[model samples]
Target: MEFTEPKAYTRSLIPFLDRSHSVAKPGFSRWLVPPAALCVHLCIGQAYAFSVFNLPMTRLIGVSQSAPGDWKLTELGWIFSIAMLFLGVSAAIFGRWVEEGGPRKAMFTAGILWAGGFMVSAIGIHLHQLWIIYFGYGVLGGCALGIGYISPVSTLMKWFPDRPGMATGMAIMGFGGGALIASPLSVWLMGKFASSTDVGVFNTFIVLGCAYFVFMMVGSMIVRVPAPGWKPEGYVPPATATKLITKNDVYVYDAIKTPQFWLIWTVLFLNTTAGIGVLGQASAMSQEMFPGHITPVAAAGLVGLMSLFNMGGRFSWASLSDFIGRKNTYFVYMCLGFALYITVPYAGGSGNVVLFVFCFLIIVSMYGGGFSTVPAYLKDMFGTRYVGAIHGILLTAWSAAGVAGPVLVNYIREYNVTHGVPKAQAYNTTMYIMAGLLVIGFIANFCVKAVDKRFHMKTDEDKDLGAARAPAGAAQAVPGRA
Candidate 1:
């Protein structure tokens, strides 16, 4: 029997919380699909690494046509932040279309816009037209962020009901790696063509823009969702697994009213604020604090390594969470993150490269883990009826982090520089602030209770999410199907 989709009231977007988990199909293997999915994943993942572009992006603006706050940094930030900000907004706006279009279609559009954003940003950078950068990459990339992020996350979970943690990790890991890829690529291209020594910023922009456009297009064209009526081979949804909420009952408007979303939002915001501050300013921080010891290129490379940690943490650590449980994993992430923040500055100040690398990686991994573990967390709390939209909304926290991270890092750095505070001392103070924020995040994560009855669609069973947290069929899964 075909499962009937629930009708959400005034809900333009319907999340794919298919209740049947009946995934009662023939034999299928979840492992076979991730390689193709990874392509789409890495491209979307570019958002994670966009700060790599910020690498002297501020300098580029300073030299291009304007001064610091006048237009350059502001323009550049607008372009980048818009992508993140819009990801949440557009996901809320376009979620139903994603369900209708399926992963393949959603990813294709995502691929196009994502790559196109680079090409467009390249144009703005090349021509030294700041507004164009905002218009092209900002708006377009935002759309890509919304669609690309959602494309594989839920679908992969459904297909690999048995390994939701691992499957989702593989795809989201690419996002973590996107920065790793972009950092090296951007640096390479800059050195080859723009060469901070000679080519100036505009030429560097054109070259990297073309390269990213090409690289991203290759990924977008290849993305696909599993065939319908498919399930991971040997997968089985336990008889105890059931739905607490259905689509027809909850609307986005209805969702915001509940305490669950707000609490989750706090969890997301604090986690992101704690980690992203370092990520955004990693290269600059490294350079400023260790100016006598590390070269610009080495500082940049360290940023790339953090990206590797970011990417690896998503898949590696978060997959580990599946067995350990999401809450337990988060407890580790926030608590450890707090400790890491405490040490980062001392390591930077003492020029302890080894400690610096270790602390930094741990911090970045938690950043990635936060993203990877959240989907499962949401499924556990609010139910998946509006997961895509809920996930989208949760990411608004990322946008907020974008603002918070850059501002906190840069502001502190500026304050220090202006005051003649040693570069090393500047970030040390900020690290304390970040650590404090993370401590709050730790407490918040400890506080995340299941959704209250008011948030349930039709009944209180939603509050009793024991087996309801599961998805699709595992035992009946079929090869090449979801």
Candidate 2:
């Protein structure tokens, strides 16, 4: 005898959160997807503005100054470092799951972790426990960052196959621009909540956490993947593919084995390493480089301006890549970056504040461009089938650069000062070293060739190997097959 499932059991399921629930029907606007992606990216992008909290947190107990028991700057610095460490780790570990599970599921999970992390950190603040904050925001929030970051990438690429670089630029640009909103918003929130006795960090965390969750959920609700075999109306495939742009698909795991993968990885690593060092120290570097010309307040403004350049570069450079090609784009970043880095020391020594600012603005723009361009680069090399997952693995380069860049900048400058170099010129040696690193990046970019055919997926089954992981009936539920 056939039995019907209980109504209560059926009611227990939340179909809205499923991957199939998010597939777009015929004529759904692909334009809607980038804003949805921005929802997740802008919120996660707050990581860049997290430094705003460091001083306030240190003053929590003291109210206006450091108390004997308050956390030190060195210790608090690890909050961001740990978050970045796990950002790369979680992305690499969960990337394949994100690829198979779909953007909606990944976004839902990210919203929860991202919001929950802030709540947990708020509790940590209430208790004055640093380690708890680390676990909450650094580890858990970082996982959210990794998931949220990659979630929209492949979806955007799929939606705009004709212009993958431009599509991704629109989404990733939100991440770079997130700091623009977060810095001021965070400061305002802290101001409103501040009192004589309370520094308001806890309340700020609680409110920001709740607010970010709402926005991220909206993104999740709005996002939809394209139907299987869907292409833009009137779009034409490139009749003749270049060696660099592969028409073939590669399995996620096999793509890593190719020399091209490592070469591209090195290209990203060196490029990131060269710029990231200066990005963190921009304010200090500017002030030291042009002592009388750039004040502390002016230095802060320079940092904010760099954020804009960084944000603009993500969209501009990535879109340019769609036209000029990804390989040529990196050639520009490395070549242009090397010249700028070499020139920075001279700009400082000659007291040319205008030239110094111009140099870093361009350099930081390329730094931001490198980030947004790589997903499309991976798409070109490995094929779109597994570009998101492959991109996730590649972010380990960023995690490494996060540590390496800061350490190199901080220690080198310190060593120079201790050895009798003037404060104004301490960064000169570091600038030359960065220029040298960019040369290595250029060579690595030159070495990148098309992925060998052996790395290509041989069967349609291999290409869609994990498609079964999708929820049953998802295809039927949504008009979109993919």
Candidate 3:
């Protein structure tokens, strides 16, 4: 079988959209790159706020207007699930493409798919077709999420090689914060467009879609890959690095084969599983645990507060990793997360809302920190040669946790209830299960070691040769592939 290639016209145009080939103008500041990445991430991160639409979408017809039997929460639930499923799948599949194409092309394509997904979903909603919404937002939008999420990571890593943790933390921090911005923005938009005659979700989708398209386009235009072999001024690599940090490059394919990669994968999976489980039920758990003390509005406030902590942790913990190292950072997440999970049940049982909220906030911050720090962790283990692809493959853990977290939490809670456990105590079992998962994650962290030297790429013979071909001063600055 033969595959068709992009036409010459398309091929020629790609360089314009390719970050690697773009000339870095003199006096170019690497700091500008983070904001560009932020633009893409902040838009796509709206996926986390999708639940905000669930209730409104269900009421698309009857609550205020239209015919009966519009959509159910279960059906709407599939929209979020499908989006997450495709987010992981697309990231894994298209990761190499993103690496090859460069950030500009990848991000531009992401904008098209992400924003286009919304427009398509708008049409689906306008026409009252559930499957259309699924395909539009779930399939295409999810693909956009995956591509957009990883597009900036490698670039940021390369730009801030001396502070990989902080670089990635900045961009991924936007993702955690994206929901904070979008949740309120979405509610306000829906209200502005809504009426007794219509729920206004369709129009809200169209507006957000167009707005995000324009915003993401700005990111694509602004983002540029570092000049070949570029390094920060006056920065030096450690002469003798710790065991957790590798100075070798492992190709993405080779990376997955390494025990280190799978260990990190397990670490990420467990951390996310524990964090997302609590997040999935935050509002409901708040109300159930302290029925008389917490109102519906207060529960919503609690969820929002957690989002703030989540966003803050991404920046703070990841930056802290720069000083402490990636392995130790995750050690903090797993160990502290384990302790906090154990405390949640006690806090909830005592009806101490302050204690309960405090424990969850810390847990979520570590959760966000886990996400922001992993790319740097991969860079430490495998090197920058294929960090993006490695990171993309690792996100499959997140996709799995997206499903597993909620299912595990919901099932345990439901089982407890069915067995006649009190509503407040119903979550006790789930909390313990989460703590156990964290223990497993802590063990995985303990197992992580530097990749074997044999897995490292030969800088002269491999892809780093391109950097060697660069002009003199630039060539010396480029670090050898590890």
User: How many residue pairs clash in all the candidates, one count each?
Assistant: 17, 4, 2
Candidate that beats the other on TM-score, 1 or 3, i.e. the better one = 3
Estimate, for each residue in 1-482, the C-alpha lDDT of model 3 and write its tens digit.
Answer: 11222232135455678443443665789989999999999999899999888888988878573347878889899998899999999999888667656788889999999999999999999888999999999999999999999999998998998999999999999998888888889999999998877777998999999999999999999897776667788988788767878777777777889999999999999999999998879999989998989999999898888989999999999999999988889889988888888898888877788888889999999999999999999999998877898899999999988879999999999999999999989999999999899888989989998898777775656544433443332221222221
Q: Rate the local accuracy (lDDT) of all candidates.
A: 0.66, 0.88, 0.86
lDDT string for model 2 (96-144, tens) is 7677567888898999999999999999999999999999999999999
Minimal lDDT window, size 10, model 3: 473-482
Query: Which residue pairs clash within candidate 3?
Result: 248-482, 249-482
lDDT of 2: 0.88
Tell me the tens digit of each residue's lDDT in model 1 across 209-249.
Answer: 55555654554344444445555556665655334222222
Model 3 clashing-pair count: 2
Which regions of candidate 2 are displaced past 4 Å?
1-13, 461-482
Question: C-alpha displacement of 92 in model 2, angstroms?
Answer: 0.3
What is the C-alpha local distance difference test score of candidate 3? Answer: 0.86
Any runs in candidate 3 off by more than 4 Å, and if so which?
A: 1-14, 63-66, 462-482
Better model by TM-score, 1 or 2? 2
